[model samples]
Target: MDRKLNRELVKATALRSGYSFTKLAQEVSVSTESVSKWMSGETNPRPGKAIKLGKVLGLSYEQMFGVRDRTLEPQVAFRLVRNQDPSEEHHERAREMGRMYEDLVPFLPFNQFEAPPRLKSPTADYEYLDELCGSLRREMGLEADVPVSLPSIFNHLSDKLQAVVIPVFWGHRKNKAELAAHIYSRKTKTTWIPFNLDTKLWDARFWAAHELAHVYTFDVLDDEAGEIFSDAFAGTLVFPVPIARAAYEELAKVRLKTQKFNLIVEFAKRMHVSPICVAKQVDRYAVAKKQPPVNAEYDGIYAAISRMSKREKTVAEEFFGGEEPSVGQLLEAAANIFKSPFFDTLSKYLKTNGGSPSFIQGLLDCSLVDAKALNSELA
Candidate 1:
């Protein structure tokens, strides 16, 4: 029929500028009824009418078009270029999140089996990610036993990976936390949240673990789904085939023996992931293996992202609070997170030092890095 526009803000935007539905319709050459339907999301707008309406409503084609920002935004697509270094502020925030990764790596329940469905990268670049983190729990064989060392762990992948640390701020004009909470990048090589939320050390690791799983999704699938596949990747990483099977077998025996494995807690201790993730992993394996999902009795899950409170550190949880709101956003935050001057300086230092130092150490060499807060405090 006609083009769609911002239904909620249509009257406000139109009224503010002495515009109205009739005027909008005239601009787009559509009937008033048609314009009403489009506003209610009942029907999509035709490209032509949609473009015309956008101007009348004082909106850009992108907003009027209603495309997901991460999926269709030009800059998001540009991130695929892999030339921009993640902002230091963002990286420092990520480093805070990295603490969680470091804590969980040690306890990760490596399955190394249940071979994940492999997909090859279609090209040198693809965007693979999504918001479903529970899926990552099952795939990674996390078993709640993993620990992530932000400083040392990420040092290994600096070459092949393009890690971005987005610092989330709260009560800081714009809420960056929401943006940082979800991620979008094209390299498929890797996008590191290094630091996210503030539940505990393990929680941060869980976020890191999830993003690390993203690295694999890009590597194997060779396409760009953003966070959608990230869930699958994280599930695979935490639950891997071997561990899933082992958990199932163990649970089966537990059922038979009328015993309690406390699988959730046990896995958490072992994998450094949250007990909640463990429970979900169990359920995933059970369902995938043709068994009943984990019982509802085991439904309560611990929040892995709550680690920030444990440290009494205000940095990670402030997904919206920051000195410079712009710098705290994802790509920009990474450059400033480690207290570095910016990516260029860090890159230069890495080039001089052979990119061998840990992420924190490298930050020390760069100028303008908030070394004190980023050091042992957040590190």
Candidate 2:
């Protein structure tokens, strides 16, 4: 990241991508003058600032600064799949990562499960996905145009789908350098995990939407044959095919930023998906459209209706909305009223394992060996 290249990448990407420094400033929530200073290399960008530029410019710290291994000293950041608990600096990083996830890689499958089956196979379990999707469509009364937040979409399907959302960071604790939100299926909906405490408002919102795509879009399609079907369905439902196509056309003219960054922002706006998902979709669309530098991976996102909706609504009111409830507040809430294990299993699991549970009891409220032993294998 020599001074020369940093300036070149920023200016070229901006001009080619058809973006203004003002837009960059807006993306990072800073002033245009600051962007100017960074472009001129007049002053070093703060760690937080540098990360933003890197994301927007499609470069890394080492690639952006002539200096390698530049120190990152941001007060806060929110990333995908990094920290279990975020520091304020880390939280901001996480949000930044969320923006990337929402805008770029948004539709990429968050498969906590094994890959779906291939097509034309007798093993294809189309019923589950179809029932789940149909149930949601019925429950929400969603027209093709309904613009529900991702979480609301999940809440709508939680109970019947039997799953919940959890946020994860791969390497860091709470920094935006790397964090991701995941949806997990469970016997009891209450047993799902949650986003990190320090996640940003917008990130939380998009995570909800992306997860909802999973809940809704995977139902009617054959995902196992190839992930492309479910991935496309999620993108289509969450973002709508027409809008995304239009946005893609607009972005194609820009050459300043890599298609990675351009598609990330443009498609995210069109469909309101997370940046990461947008990136994933861009990859899928590229391949489907016969392009390169994109991966065509898909995971399914379908579920039952009656249960998911209720639980999701509670999460929207509580965690995402930032309201604290008394134990009684939670207790009085009917078990069946919301998704089975979301709020409860979420609270309990996050408190203990922070999500990576190995035990079935820990993941679901089911008796594993004990139930079987007592039923038939009794001595």
Candidate 3:
């Protein structure tokens, strides 16, 4: 049987519900065009889907088709490659993950997540970035001039920021949107950062710092300025001013181009960041100190670093003991190694709320067979 919705009531309720057209359609397992048609009175939903829609909207059928009421957009900070926008599919998947975070918060073992205080009138200027990074490093009990241990940083920030760190094996092959995602659920007031564990661990560290910048200064909607802030913040946080100044001083004393390149490469190796990150930071430091910038071109440095980075294992590979791991092993690694409560939370949600293995597959973005195996283990 089909149930006809009052078009005006549906539109009003959907708007008041604060769900985007895509998300609303997702929650109801329908196409956005179908949602559009239903809201426009061009179509009606089947009885089962209609009931599901009402439940997802937290309203009884009488209230959904009869009455209307109530609001928050998720703040999405995608760490995309330069000049690239994630595909709509990627955005939809990220939003679904955000929805899961919203559903899982009540079962969290700690207090409600609180965002770190936003910077007042934050600027992306070099001086401001340097000072902010220095202060943050001190707060994290890290030495300003030494390379940071990513494991320490991860553990510290996970507890300090009170954010969920979800490590995902998006794919073994890298893509533009493969590093990290920062999604803030306004409804839950929680920040959910999902790290793509397919990239090199060095790249992951830098990207993690970038997301940390987003978490700390997430005052308003993300914009170009916010991205600028995050990029600068990540570089400075990983390679502080003191370290950059020292590297600059060392490079200044070197006259040969190869010597300078070697110095930069060594700095990158020591810092566990890309050569471009080290090169750019040193140039920025030189400019800030009114010194001549390093006289090296970066055309070849990129390729050289790319070849060098292939030797390192990604976060997931390391967690799984450097071989293709089973789905169950991946879930265990996510829990025991990454210390992520996401799987446990999902397990509890399934047991209490009565869900299927398909829910696990969707939330973890895994195969149905793997999800079933994982479900039995979680059960």
Candidate 4:
């Protein structure tokens, strides 16, 4: 390959790896100047150094030279708050997971489906956003006002939208609150949304809706406003305007502010959403209805809910009989795809090399013992 092409590939891989040039240079046993030159297309590494660099970036020698192999390229969209900063490690891990998904896709049973058209503008009106969600719900044969079933939504997305909804256990625990991610591959025309399973069921469902909003409107929104729009769209999708208004009105009838706490809990349970989400939705409903805001009282209600000792298990847990699906479930869902000779060859290679356990552990974020168990299960 030409020096310029090699440079571009190196830069792309480095960005995906979330590694600085100096750090990558140290890993490859090259000087910072040499790495800079390689990136700038002024110099090319020796064959031995190039091989080492490829290994560090998890790329094959051909891939390092800008050759197009069968690997998939995934574009990731994170659903994080504006103020939060994701560490480089987080970025790299996300990319790594994307690559893993890419490898698994060819084995999965995927249908070709197109996502909804992107909104023309990032600041689409609330009514328009609401209509979008309603349209989607109707398309999926769901009632606009009813609480959505998570598993049902997952199946619809997988079957009709050609999207995969997977619960990932790999992200940083501290960032679990804001760790939803959507990965879209233009080449494969598929989408993957992974929610952090560590969160409450209500929050997980909300995050799922948020990621779906992104999938529907990603091309139209600017980076900053996309998050805001997706948040609004998700809340509206999970709790429609009419339902939210009725909920707020019911709570408003409670004469004492303190008495409304129980009503809030009941409303949340009925809506299948967290109390915090209900509180925020109530605020939004109030704003839309031109009613006086109940911010202070809702804060108190939230605090009271937090003080409770035991909380109810999420709807998902109850529906699944307290057994949450894991990476094994995902693999099983794509079982037919893995029956290919490629996987058979790879499995044999790993087993012969005694690398099966470590590979499984790393890929699924399991401990060594768990990985060994998984290997046995697969065998």
Q: Which candidate achieves the best lDDT against the true structure?
A: 3
User: Which candidate should be chosen as best, given TM-score against the real structure?
Assistant: 3
Report per-prediction Cα RMSD to one decimal. 15.2, 19.4, 8.2, 8.9
TM-score ranking, high to low: 3, 4, 1, 2
lDDT of each: 0.43, 0.42, 0.73, 0.63
TM-score, every prediction? 0.42, 0.35, 0.75, 0.66
Clash count for each candidate, listed in order shown: 118, 93, 1, 1
**Residue-wise lDDT of candidate 2 within 253-329, one digit each (tens)?**
65544453645554555454455555554454554456444331222211221232233332325443546433344
Cα miss at 37, model 1 (Å)?
36
Clashes of 2: 93
Q: Candidate 4 regions off by >4 Å? A: 1-73, 79-84, 112-124, 170-179, 314-362
Worst 10 residues of 2 by lDDT: 183-192
In model 4, the Cα lDDT at residue 190 comes to: 61
Model 2, position 156: C-alpha lDDT score: 51
lDDT of 4 at 302: 51
lDDT of 4 by residue, 36-100 (tens): 98888776665456767878988776676655443555566775543377543444345445655
Give candidate 1's error at residue 290 in angstroms: 3.6
Model 3 C-alpha lDDT per residue in residues 1-379, reported as the tens digit of each score: 1235876666677789897778999999889998887887786664445667777777666565553221364667676644377664466456656766687788766565444566777777899888888887888788887776665556655667766777776664345355788888877778878888786766776888887878777755356788888888899989888888888999889877678888988888888877778888988888778998675445576677678777877777666666778767777766666566777877787788876776776566655776788788775
lDDT (Cα) of model 1: 0.43
Model 1 CA deviation exceeding 4 Å by range? 1-148, 151-153, 166-200, 215-228, 239-246, 253-262, 291-293, 296-379
Is 1 or 4 the stronger prediction by TM-score?
4
